[model samples]
Structure formats: structure tokens, C-alpha cells
Target: MTCFPVVCEVESVMLEMQDPKTGVKSQPQRLVITTIPHAITGEDIVAWLTNCYSIEAEEAWALGTMLVAFGYIYPLQDHKRLVIKPDASLYRFQTPYFWPAQQWPVEDTDYAIYLAKRNIRKKGTLELYEQVQYNSLHKWMNHKWDFIVMQAKEQYRAGKERKKPDRVVFDCQERAYWVVHRPPPGTVSAMDYGLERMVDPNTEELLFSCLFSLFSSLVKYSVTYNKHDPFLAPCLPSNPWVTDDVTYWLLNMANVEIPTKMRVERWTFSFGELLSDPRGRDDFRLFLKKEFSGENLAFWEACEDLKWGTAATMNDKAQQVYKTFLTRGAPRWINIDGKTMEVTVKGLKHPHRYVLDAAQTHIFMLMKKDSFGRYLKSPVFKDTQKRAILTTVENAQSKMGIIILKRRPSISPIIVRQLEQEERARMATSGPVDITQVMSKLSNKGKEVPPSKK
Candidate 1:
């Protein structure tokens, strides 16, 4: 469960010595405890708490403040600090594979030994299974969840391996992960692309569920410590409030149609596909144009072309691309954050291929989260998909014909007895003579002619 910091106000009243001297005189000292909350202006947390717990509270704060506070619920941060981006040094357990873990600094066996020692020290046991499981799952979730998908048509593409690529990718700009693999080798009867269309609160909830599950498993393997029997076995959170609200808010922000897939042999598609395909690119551009953000994709594509072009082309167009997209006053300037724009501009004096990486990544991601979802849902894409499906159905029906010829009758019990008898008679007349008769004929001919030859 996630934790969040909370603030509350407390009040105390004190009796002074003046009351003792008078034997009846009481001096009340109001002690105020500092804290805060949302409600009608000046309503402060103190009054809300008072009203919630005790009696009808009179409003002390101004009317404007009260209006601002009314019905404004605090947000949830249920996934706080769950995104564990460890530094290079601590990546000792996961630096081996280049497919999922991009960077490598050590050999596989060496890393295994390092993990063993590390786990034994920390967990008091040599069981590193959970660690590796989480390491892989976290890598998969953070990296590959977005890019992987299986298209039904790719199964028939000749020379395309039936095997899926063993890779996972986390596109930072897209804010999604994907696991790519080949679709199962067969004609797909029907396909359902259950693409995530909205932020899944359940994912965040499930993540904590898994975390607590792993934590419980780890505790089972723990050993006793000196002067204590280790500690009580860790248990799962019992209360919903145990989770942090800030994380949930952040996750909601991240997960919302941020153009978010994986598993069962996912297909990895390239942004180049988006840029190169005439129909696709034009459709996407049109969607962005409608949104008045067409320049973002245009700028991104230009940077990509410049980055991949020849050295001479890069040198010629680098300044133009930079000025057009990165500069503040330039025409068709994109809406990248200031930092990315500044970095891109700074590097324009002597531009290289990677100069626009930061800015391009930002724009690419901006389009992905901001416009990509809408593009998928746009009438253009829907109509295109509908047309494609209709075309496929037409082609299939035309090729196969309306009346499908079957090898057998529709009724299992119905039989043509006359046809069966005629087939048997035909086979009897046309089939080869028995092997016994052929051998007897040869024997008789040999007996009749061989006596004189001897």
C-alpha cells in the first residue's frame, strides 16, 4: 500500500494561575495547532473536522473561500514511488539482456552470483526467484506494454517468420510498454484488438496487489535475527486508505488514452511506418490538422528525415528544421517544452544526427498522448478500417464463391447405395489380378518350357 502525508489541526484550552487566586476566576487560553484543508474560504481544516466529528459549525472564513473549497475532493496518489528507476550501480541484477535491458555492463553468470549474494544478505535466503520475476515484469511493464500488438493479416506474409521477436520496448514518449512476438501460425478466425482506451485504475491497484503478494512471499523466506525472532510476517494492506493519492493522480494522468499492449506475440510497429505510409501519415496529419496541432507531427517527421538523411542533407536542412520547429518566433513552431526547445536550439549551430533527439522525442510523445488516441478513433481511421474489412470480406467471398463445394453430404446418415454398389463393381473389374494367380501362371509356363532347356 502507498503512503501519503496528511495534515490536521488540533486545539487546546489552558487554565491560568489567575483562576487559582480568585478560587473561581477562570482564564481561558486558546491554543491553536497549525494545519490545513480545503472547504469554503477560511473554513480551514479545523472547521471541517469539527463539523464532521462533533456539531454544527458556524462559518468563520469569507464566503468566497468557502465556495472555492466546496466539493473539491482531494486526489488519490495510489502509485507513489512505485516506478523504481534504479541507478546503474544497483542494476547489478538486471544488466545482462540487451533485448529488454538495453544496457549491459557484466556477464550473465557473474550477475547471477552478485544477485545471489545480494539476496542472501537482504532476504536471509538464496531465493532470488521473486527478485528476477519482478525485475523482468517491471521491465516488461515499464518498457514493452505499448508497442506490441498482433495483426491477423501478418500471419500469411511469406518470409515473415511464424516466430515472434523476443523483445520488449518501453517508448518513453508514448508512455507505454509493449512485448512483441509473432502471432500463432494459423488462419485467425476472428480478431479483437483490445487496445487500452482509457486509464486503468485497476492496473495501479493490481500493481500494489502484486507488490504485497511478493512481499508476503519474501517474508516467508526470511530468517531470525539476534535478540528477536526476525519481525512479524509482513501482511497485505487491509484498508483502502493505505494507498497514496498522489500516485493514483499521476497514473491517471499517465494512463489516459496516452496511446497505450503486449503478449501473445506482439507486433512492433515503427514511427517510420506512420511517417512513410501515404494513407496513414495523411490521415494522422489530417487529424492533427483538425486539432490545430498538425505542425507537431510535421516537425517531428522533418526531424526524423533530417536525422536519417545523408550528411550533406543534414548539414543543409539542419538549420532550417531547427529554426522552423525549435525557435520561438519561427513559423510552424511546435509546442515543445521550453527546455527541449532550448536544447535543440543550442545544438543547431553545428547540428548532428542526435541534436533533435530530446525535442523530437517530446513532440513524438506529445502527438502520441495528445492526438494519437483521437486519430485511432477518428472517422478517417474508422472508415478506412470499415472499408478494409468490407474489401477483405468481398475478396474472400468472391475467391471462395457463394456455394462452397464440400467433399461429403450435409446429412451424415444419408447414403447413395446404388452409387456405392457401382463403385465396387467398377473396382472389381479394373483392379489388378491377384498375386497368387500371376505366380501360378509363371510356374506353369516355366514347367512347360524349362524341361528341354535343361
Candidate 2:
């Protein structure tokens, strides 16, 4: 007779009994079971049952089911776990075959299109969304959105929590934007590079409005004249830097003081530095307004804001932006040059997300060359500069009080002479003097001398 020792701990015991009416009785059998250790796998337990217990295949299977039900064993989810010996063919960077199947499972790609569409719709990528929705999945279809979905799905299937996008789809309404190509892994799309996304929506809207007002006037000027001037300068008087509810609302949202610290010293900063500080940029906009060329700065800033705004609001913002800044006579127009303006205006008819690139670039260059230098020399800016320096001096003085030596109350002649005598006496004696004898002599002399009463 052969004996097999079961290597398992008993988890639970149950008694079998008979049903009264049907008279069906079950045997009260003692079932001795084994529990799998945490470190051991289901296959290991099965092998243990076969080798140690020497059980028949059927009995081993029966025990296997019970072990699995008791949470004592589990099947490996990673297909690679089955491969005892991994070879070069087992793992490849492009594609690997852990299973016997010659082809790796083509991850269900049907949702790729739908997910891309939904993402485009969510992000306001109208051209891409429409392309994916109406057209076949081709090279032109925005692969970046599809890639994001694939990565997200892969992460989820791998037991990682799904990731959400932290960036906005579009930061500016005026600029037409589209994803041209799929970005490499670990890099942002080309459209997103060097663009601001996180901005106050109200500020974005106000900037759009300002640009619209400027461009609308330009378009009106263009239609009346047959020969549109390429280098038309703004001749209008400067508009006061308007502070309506929008400005206050945005400030409150940011929890920052108005015309922030940077705004006060706008004249001293370069255009690049001004771009980083919203308040400084705003002050520069006021200078541009004074020059009657505020539209250039407004359009550029609006584009930046929209570029960095949440990705979801891009489409509608883009449309409104196009109508306002690019379209002829649209409200709050950015007065771009004729050739560029015409190109932008035509592009607006079939606006893709990046259609405003030429115009934005033109305006950026225009502002950098023209308004920036003049801004430094502008009377308003110079005045502000003077006030800034004065304010700085005053603030410093207040923070750190000035110390002045009051003319030492002129020392009395007698006290000065006594102090000199004391200094000489101290210098002459190296050892300690007997003060008791000196004091007695002085008192005796004082008593002998007649006292002069004043």
C-alpha cells in the first residue's frame, strides 16, 4: 500500500445530513482538506497533490476546484508567467510572443476611432473629430487622441488606475489649432509646446474682445479701399485700460491684487519678461492702446491664453476667436496687415485650429519690433517708471528707518576736563590704588577748607 501526505492546512469542516420529507440521507463524511500557502501557486498545489498524495488525476482535479474556491490559489493573468524559459523570441521591443500563437493579440482597435472622435469632440478638435467621425481611419485622422486612449486603456488593463489629462484642449479661441502628427512617447503635441494653458477665462474673453474691436475696424477699412495698405498704423486715441466686471472677476478668482507687482514696473521689462507677468503684459497693452496698436499685443496674448486654456473649450473658443479677430469687420478685430489679414480671413471660412498661426506670428513680430521699444519711451511708461522708483525708495525707507546722529549735546567744559584727568590718571597707574587713604585725605581737606555757599 502507498501512502501520500497532503501538504495543506485544513480551512473548514461541514457535516452532511438527511432531508426529512424526501428521506434522502447524505453520508456524514470527514473531509480533510489542505490550504495553499500564500507563496505557493495553483500549479504548485496541483503538483504537490499529485506527487505527495499520489492521488489519481480525477481526485487531484476535484481537490484543485476546492482549493481555488477557498481563495487558496489563482491563475496567472500575465501570459508570460506560463513560459518557464524565456528566450530572445519570447520578448521583443516591437512585439513579443509569450503564447504559442504566432500573432500577438491585436488589442481591440474598434474603439480607437470612437474614442478618438469622443476625445476630439470633448477637446473641441472640430476638424479632427469630424475627420474621424465622417471619414475612414486614415493617416490624417488625429492619431494623438487615439494614442492617448490606447495608452489609457493599456494602463487600465494592466491594473493601473486610468489617467486623466491635466491640460486644456485649446488655450485661445482666435487661433485655429489642429494636431498635425502624433507626438512621440513622453512628449506633448507640437501645438502645445511653449504655450500657456492655465489662464483666467475672463481675461481670455476680454483680450478676445479687445482684438475683435481692433480687427473689426481694420476690416471695415479694408472693404472701402480697393488697394488695401499693408502697413496701416492705428490713428485712434488710446482707450483707457477698462476695468469692468471681467477684470475684477478674474482677479478675485486668482486671489491676487490688481495691476500686480510686475505691472508697476512694466517699462523696465523686456517683451519676453513681460509675457511671463500678466499684470506687466496688461500694462504693456495699455501702452499699445496709447500707440493705437493695442490689437497686436491683445491678439498675441489671447492666443497664448487660449493655447493654455483647458483642452475641452478649444472649438467654440476657436470659432468665436476666428469671428472676432480674423473675419472681416468682426467685432473686436485684430488689425493685421493686408496680405496676412486676407490669408487669415480666408482661412477663417474653413477654420482648422492652427489657421491663426500666420496672423499670430505676424502680430508677435509687429509688437516686438514696433510697440516694445516705443513702450519703453512712452510718456505714460516713463512717468510710471519715475513713480515706481519713488515708491520703492519710500517703501524701503518705511521698512528700514533711517538712523541720524543728533549733535551730541555739547559736553560741558568741566565734565570734559574731569574726563580728561580721569583718563590720564588711569593711564599713569598700572597697579590698583588704595582708594580709602585718598578719600580720607580729600574729606579732611574739605572739612579744613571753608565752604563757599552759592
Candidate 3:
């Protein structure tokens, strides 16, 4: 189990109290028999609480006492009574490890071990309550009583090596922790949640039924909308991100003149989908107007505007909405139950953005259950469905034609430059040509001068 909210809040206060400068003053206060280091007086604790929270002395004292009862601060002198004295009674902040917010279970085994350890140190001179518990636990755990005693002996021996003051402080801290957790009989335990401790035999069956219902609902919803999910199902024509074809987006624009077959079909998924899409809302609004119940949609739209509109215009818009749709004999008045009307009117006395939320929800359900189903079966929906554009294979092929060209990789510039240099070197190595001989050969191209030349 987690710590209660009150325990968590007290832990934060305790943290602030432990601060060096602003927290309660501490010193080596000498108790009647022992000198305890860094112990705070009760007066200082109450004063600190008053100053920190700006509360009255009485309230601060109550808060301090509560902290003590919860084991955040432990009294050194009077360990039996767990309350702030508002005087010079020495108290110390309990270690964070022992704070109630740590959610440590107050188990009998642990308490038995603590009592056994205390009995060993005090030579069996345990307090009356501790002795009673010790005896009971000893008898109940008779099988493991020897092991418990052996563990207590080890802990007692380890404490002997610590300094006298440190050992005394630790023993007091441990005693205080047990006293708070296992309080005397007839005293209420702060940790107890009465009636919650009882277990119901049918709880497991109820839990399994709830889990099955939740799982079945989730599976049904996913299956119903699986084909409409953009990630799971491909967009028709093509996905713009992959093919750079924007026809899909154009066909599904929020207020498109004509919605696609798939877009029109999505309005049947849920009432929320119809309201979310501008085109779908327009179709629904038209149907409502034909039924002479358009005021419901208008009122719902006004509420949505008020919800998302700027804060500066919130009150003015709220007043306008109330006067137009909610007031007696208003032009666009919508029907709502008497209780919802009373709540809305009372809230409008000092209007906020959500003043019409109850009425809006009422009108929404009215339209969804009555008008929405009729609209789906009426001529309006069927006409739209018939006019809804379908993406054909030929249209997609035509749009994809521009993207079908095959591209060849070009030669590198560095390779081209190297080839040019090699051609120039070959021409240079062949040396210069005889211009006169080259001209004569060109002039006597068809003449046979090979024999004379040889």
C-alpha cells in the first residue's frame, strides 16, 4: 500500500523543518538522565509551525501533535504519550527511513525482533505493553523464537560499539517508531483504515468480469474502425508522402465540396466523428434543419466556441450564447431538462466558459440518439453517399505517369577529365604532322603515288 496523501504532505513539512537556517533550533539538551544531541524543544516546534504556515498557536500545536502521532517527530522524555507539550520537552526529527511515508509494513516479526532486542539490553525490564506483546509473540512464534532471539543478540552486540549518546538516541528512535505503529490497546492507530481491512470473497470474480468487459469493448472498437485508421490502411489514390500525389489530401480536405466514399463512410463510425469533420457537421446540420430541430446543433456549436474561444471574449460570448439559446422565448432556444436548466441558470449568475456544458451535453445526446440515426437512414445521407467520389485504378495510373521515367546515372566529372587528358597525351607523343605532304595527299586523293613515294 502507498502512503496516504496526509502522510505525504506531512513528510514535506518535516523536510522544511529539518532545514538548518529557517527550521526549529536544536541543541544538546540534557534530559534528566541523559544528554541528547540535536534535540528540539516542543515550544520551538510549535513556533516553527506557526511561523512557517502563518497559522494560530492552537492550530500549530495541533499540527505538531499530528506530526508526532504520525512518527515524523518522536518525543524523548515522554515516549508513551505521542503529542507535543508546547514546552521544553525534548524531541528529535525521526530519520527519513522510519517516516510513515516510507510505506514500510508494520509486521509482527519485525516488532517481535525489536522487543526481543530491547529486552536483551534492559535485562528484561521492558515496558508493560512491550512485555505483553513480547510474551504473546514469543508464544505465537514458538517454532522460530530461538532464531528471533539469536538475531536480537547480534543487533544488541552491534549497538554496543557505538558511542553512548548515539546508542541512546538510536534506541529511543526505534522505541518511538514501534510505539506509534503498535499503539496501546484502545488507542486508535493512525495507519488503520477501518473496514478496508476486511476482504470480500467475491472480489476476484467481480474483478475478472470487469477486466473481461473492458477487453471486449476495446477489441470491438478496434475492429470497427480498423479500416479507417490511416496508419493501418493505405490512403486511396496514393499516400502524398510516398508518391507526391496530393489527390488523396484534396479529396479528404475538412470542408471539401464532395467527400470521398471512404470519408462519407467514416461518419457512421461514431457521433464524435460526424461533429469533428466540418463537412459531416454540415450534412448533419442540414438534416436537423429539415427536421425543425436545428437549434440543438447550433447550441452545441456555441458551447464549443465558448470552450475554445479567447478568455477576453469568454464572458461576452457566454452571455450571447445564453441569451440566444437558453433564455425563455429565445429565437434559437434548445430543449433541456428542468434540472439541467436550473444548474445552467444558477451557474450563469456568475458565468464561466463551461456554464453551458451540462445543457450542451444533454442536447448532444438528444441529437445523437434521435436526429443522428434518422439522418443516416434519410435521403440526405444516401444522396451524399451516391455522389461520393471513388478513386479508380485508371485515375491513379494517369496521375502516376509523370513519376514513371527511368533515370540513368551519369559519368563522373573526374573520369571525363582523365579521358580528355589521355587523348591530348597520345596526340603529343605522335609528334607534329608534315603540312605540305598532308596537303598533297588531300589534293591527289584518288591518284596512285605510292610507288613513286617508295
Largest TM-score belongs to which candidate?
3
Q: Report the lDDT tens digits of candidate 3 across residue range 1-454.
A: 3334556678788888999988888999887777889999999999999998999999999999988987889998898888999998899999999976566677888889899998998899998888898999998876455556766877899999988888889988998888887888777766554312222334666567667899999889788777677766666776687676788889888889999887888899889989999999999988888989999999999999988899999889989988998899999988887767866777777766666777888999998898889999999999999999987556667666664443235699999999999999998779987889889988889676566654
Candidate 1 lDDT, tens digit per residue, 1-454?
2211110011011011112342112222121231211111122332433343454343322221221111111111111111112111110011112212122232333333333333433463533443653355435433221111111112223213422211111111001111111112231211112121112335667577778899987665443221112134211111113322232233223223222111000111334445544446666776678778888888877877887899978877888886776666889977766655555666676677766777778887777666766766678655544443111224334334322342233543336677788899999889987999889999998878545665
Q: For model 3, give the 10-residue run with minimal summed lDDT.
A: 193-202
Ten contiguous residues minimizing lDDT sum, candidate 1: 5-14
Question: Compared with the true structure, what per-residue lDDT tens digits does model 2 show for residues 1-454?
Answer: 1111221232211100012333112222211232211122334444445655689755655665443322222222222122211111111110112111122232324334434434444574434444454344434434233333444344334432322210110111001111112222343332232122112335656578668899998787575431213244211111112211133234323224344232444325456766666656766778877777776776786677666677677666677787767676866777677766665665556545555667787887777787778877888666555553222334433333321132134689999999999999887696667899899999998889676899
- Please give the TM-score that candidate 3 achieves against the real structure: 0.45
TM-score of 2: 0.30
Task: State candidate 1's TM-score.
Answer: 0.31
Task: List candidate 1 stretches off by more than 4 Å.
Answer: 1-276, 389-454
lDDT of 1: 0.40
Compute each candidate's TM-score over C-alphas.
Answer: 0.31, 0.30, 0.45
